[model samples]
Target chain A: MDDATRVEVAASLLEAYRTRQPIEPLVEKYAGLELDDAYAIQQHQVQAWLGEGRVIQGHKVGLTSGAMQRQMGVDQPDYGVLRDDMFYPEDAPVPAGIFLAPRIEPEIAFVLSRDLTGPGVTVAEAAAAVDFVLPALEIIDSRIRDWKITILDTIADNASSGGVMLGSTPTRLSDVDLRLAGCNLYGNGALVATGAGGAVLGSPLLSLAWLANTVGRHGVTLRAGHVVLPGSVTPAQPVRPGDTWTAQFAGIGSVTARFGQETA
Target chain B: MAAHEAGHLLDPGATVGPIDLRTAYAVQAEGLALRLAAGERLVGWKIGYTSAAMRAQMRVDAPNFGPLTDRMLLAGGEPVSTALTQPRVEPEILLILGDDLPGGSDRDRVAHAVGEARGALEVVDSVWRDYRFRLEDNTADGSSAAHAVIGPLLPAGVDLAEVGVTLIGPDGERSEATGAAAFGHPLDALGWLADALAAQGSRLRAGDIVLTGGLTAAVPLPSGARIRADFAGAGEVSVRREAAVPPSRTPADTAETGT
Candidate 1:
């Protein structure tokens, strides 16, 4: 409950994140506290950053793949908040130095035109709220060093969400069969991954439904213009300096970006 | 016996070719990881891709499962090696069966056989070349589960039957879901899972650990990102994400479909 202590912890964590240093010891320093208490303190830290002018841009789902579930030993996936400072143009060069730990994942991004709410929101209903769908990439970065962390560490780090690369195509949701949409994930010009739209819980729309009900339980609403990167079409791959990754959706166009070496 | 059989769903990854659930190229991928553990051994297993969300995410409709190696297991207060994995941390409740309940929609029997409950986090990592894999590729590969860091175990008396759990992110953004989120009461789903496994010629033994499914949505954890899930009195589990070098490329890379 010490504001200074929390800020100190948050600041220290952010530094580690920027350098990709380990944060296990730091997190353990605060372990044993109530889950709610731990989160409240962290929320304050992030909100403070937001108050300084960073806008909350979107959210991310990690461990959405089956491989992640088995590897991690948990059943479901996890989520993180996205901020405007984290987004770059589809072709932006990601400075690797800012991410303590970083990876690149190919994904499909959907922008909602209307607020999506539901205990009863159906896939059809969730899809109806979409404004445009873009082929995108999520740059995942964590504040923990050595690339090691737990749910608590990730939660405190905002779910390891770093930045997003948006495509320009802007396909209409109603015009496409998201379930059938497929993407070719290319690294350095070679196809490295391929997945159908169905890879994300049947369709990316299902991710929206899951988010709607999930956030609804937390008393939050899915506002319009919010972009949801349903889940990684391909498992995330490590990005070294100078690595370029791109995702081409069958009919939705594509998004691309490059990574620079960590400088900090 | 196919472990706890829930209603059988199709794991679309099966479309590429035959997948040896116990042994295959995918298992080998996991095997390489196991070898990386130095002296770790098999501990338990988990079911993945059970929900429609997962199926669609992978463009598959069935659930996938993976083994939990000994090195991956953790109890409350246990120290973790942050160097172990390129991790994604997730919260879930592990359901240990008391009596073998048939897998189907048999809620009553499922409710009765709940032996023990605990909150745990699944620590996952991507292992394919460049860390890119399709939904089916992940599904059949046991969902690329790297480890299962379990928390303090709880006795079977815990009435997790219908409790609400919250999923908090590293930055403290919060979300909540009920036990019902896993198709409602994963224990009930366990019955069906058990039955499904039995039908497939397998059965979940007493010592087996069945990850009921995720309670909240999936969130990302960077390498070194730590995470946990507090299941009220059910105890909490922790995990750390680690960085991994890309594996050597293979022909599967050439045979990849739908790209």
Candidate 2:
């Protein structure tokens, strides 16, 4: 793809994200677009957000598990940058109008006390770098209309990352065996989905390590004090207005997000 | 611990896990001491993770530095062979000091102390498996120091605040960046390194060559790949990767190896 078109597509996606409007799949317009082109487009959008004063809070690893990858119709996982504006406080009302078609997935978030970089980072090394871990609910909303996305399309859409709500309680790694940390998602007090941390690439640490090493190849570092959201433990559940969801994790704590009525 | 692992091309395990920044640096110093005992001469230092984006990602308020040795310096315009586990290249400005500047030197003094600046490429290879590790792991691993190639040096007075850098590989993969990508100005990296060294009881001396942080993200260099970096005004440098050589068995190789 030519540089100008790349920039234009990125600008259009950025506009769609900012205005909370969904657009047609980019594959329809940019034929034979490769993964590199998708990432380039994503980077341009991220750069645009940075130019607009949006601070990078952290990053997210998406589609790490076999189920998520299968559900997403891709063989490999993808990553996305998280902005501070994308965060909603625990138990806070999530505005429905700000998203196109929102879905929620339970995840474990790692807060690092030191910088982590890789091309060769191991799971043990990644686990040892964690300052703490918390339960999180990731609200993923694809900018592509109807979410008809290929790997390239989703990657270009920032891995469908929309909003993140983090639990307040932080548990140290020594206090919890992440692989055994079971999680149950409840909507309006009714159980909807069940999973465990092991669902995320056998362990969330492995997922985090995978993200660190993959992004590190592109010259990105997972910094100290940064919060990294590993892939979902449970499949994403579609969110609707007036729906209140809670995710309880064993050993780790629980978090809740309430959706408000959509406003015009 | 890092020295032991790097010397043997081994991965960190029980002997050394992800450590705190302070412990990591201490381990790095110990590794450097071992290298010194083995007859490797320290030429200068290499500062890394200086860009705001990188620093922010690493959650570090400042950049980190590692020792540069004589053996790691490659001749300009030559084919460089590396046995590093996984290697990547970055374009940067090499600061060759003409005068001594200890810690606490101001910007003007730092500018005056520099003898010349050259376009350079640094080969960074992490010993940590999968290139994943904490700050201390990187610090202890000599900040992923592997090899460096220096270009023709330009006068110290050249305005480098906005020098453009473009790295191109034989396969036509390209990445472009500016000097500002390295801590706003490359000299700022020099100053940061000086201060950081001073805090650790070391000092930047004359004849030391400092490689400022990468202006662009590191690019993987496969065997037989020719890489060229063009630095606007400062000139250009190129290096071709030679075919890999099979590893020879050593005493360390026969010993207990950690993954």
Candidate 3:
């Protein structure tokens, strides 16, 4: 895609994210849209946000799990940038109107102490760089109308990232084999979904390592003190106003986020 | 605290004069707000005076703590500029927390919560002139922390209790120590920091970078110096003191290189 088209597409998506209004998919509007074009649009939007003084807290990997990839009909994982403003404190009430079509998924978050540069980063290297792991809830929102999105569309939309809520407890990587780490998601205090960390590219560390390498080729450095959110352990579940969601990780702790009443 | 951090010289009375550790931390929080307003992002916390000698010199039974920022981090392979005042360097171990550790967590728990252990170079630059200050004064000054360079990371299970660190300078000046110099084990210092932060109603969150106290005495950071810290098993991290340049690739460079 040309730079002008990338900028224009980014602007439209940014507007959708800002106003919580869904728009038509770019795949329909622009013919022959490739993953590279979609990522270009996403990068343009990220640059805009950075220019506006929003801090880049870290990055997130998406669609790494078989469930999500199968559901999306994609064979590979995608990534998105996490801004500081997108974080919701644990158990805080999240505003539903801030998202177009919000959904919740359970995941693990890795906090890095040492920078991880990729293309040759190994899962062991990624594991060694992790400072701690926590249970997290990723609130995914789609900017495409009716939640319809191809891999390219979602990638352009920053991998459907909306908000993240982190648990208070941290579990060391050595204490639990992340591949077997289990998660149980509760909505309104009822168990609604279940998954294991193995679902995320065999292990969440592998997913993180994959992301570090993929973005490293583009001159991005997963620096020390950055948070990396691996893809969801469970399938994304639709959410709405007045909903309270909690995700509990085996060996880790639990995190909760509540949705407030809908705004007009 | 704000006046002190802005480079304003003040009598101890005008700053953290005769304050207790609790009040000193409150002052530190206020100063941290000013830093955040000035666009400095908080990356992690640092434990100071973990060594008995330093604590005894400061006449304190416990250690002090401070915050770390993005601007204060000098990555390995990056050059350190002479933009800081009275900058000194120390070799230390960094504990990267993968979990949220509340105050009062046991050492074992702290160790279990750690995800990585790394060799580190801490650039300590006291905002206070001459580095002459009381414990409270240093506490309010962010523990004299200026910048840090994190070397390669090792898995948490690796025994860091006795890992050796060797600091080699551009002129071949060498300083060496072991992790045991940091409160017996680096995890102990981490546990102490967790408690300190917890006392302030904060916990060590996941992704928080905690710099254990200096393993060896600090030395002057001279310009044109290349400082490297070699961790016995964790690999090495180095920083060169030279000119500062933007690390980002220019569009022209990208176009030319086709990267």
Candidate 3 residues lying further than 4 Å off, grouped into runs, are B1-259
* C-alpha lDDT of candidate 1 relative to the true structure: 0.63
Q: Name the regions of candidate 2 deviating beyond 4 angstroms.
A: B1-259
**Once model 1 is optimally superposed onto the true structure by TM-score, how far is the C-alpha of residue B143 displaced, in angstroms?**
26
Worst 10 residues of 1 chain B by lDDT: B1-10
Quality of candidate 1's docking, in CAPRI categories?
incorrect
Please give, for residues A1-264, the per-residue lDDT of candidate 1 as tens digits.
Answer: 466776777777666654566566445677554434445545765676788898877677666665566676666666667778888875557887777557888777889899987667888888888889888889887666665666656666666787898988888876765654545567887545555455566457888888887767667678899988888765677777778887766557778898775566
**Interface C-alpha RMSD per candidate, 1 decimal:** 15.0, 21.8, 19.0
lDDT of 3 by residue, A1-264 (tens): 788999999999999877778899889998978999999999999999999999999998988865467788887899999999999987568878888888998888999989999889998899899999988899988899987898999999998899999887888898876764556677897656555676678678889999999999999999898889998876789997999998766567788989999762
True contacts kept of each: 0.00, 0.00, 0.00
Query: Chain B vs. true chain B: TM-score for each candidate?
Result: 0.67, 0.86, 0.83
Q: Per-residue lDDT for A171 in model 3?
A: 84
Taking the tens digit of each residue's C-alpha lDDT, what string does model 3 give over B33-65?
878889988989888887653565555566788
Error of 2 at A37 (Å): 0.7
Q: How badly does each model clash, as a count of residue pairs?
A: 100, 17, 9
* lDDT at residue B122 of model 3 (Cα atoms): 87
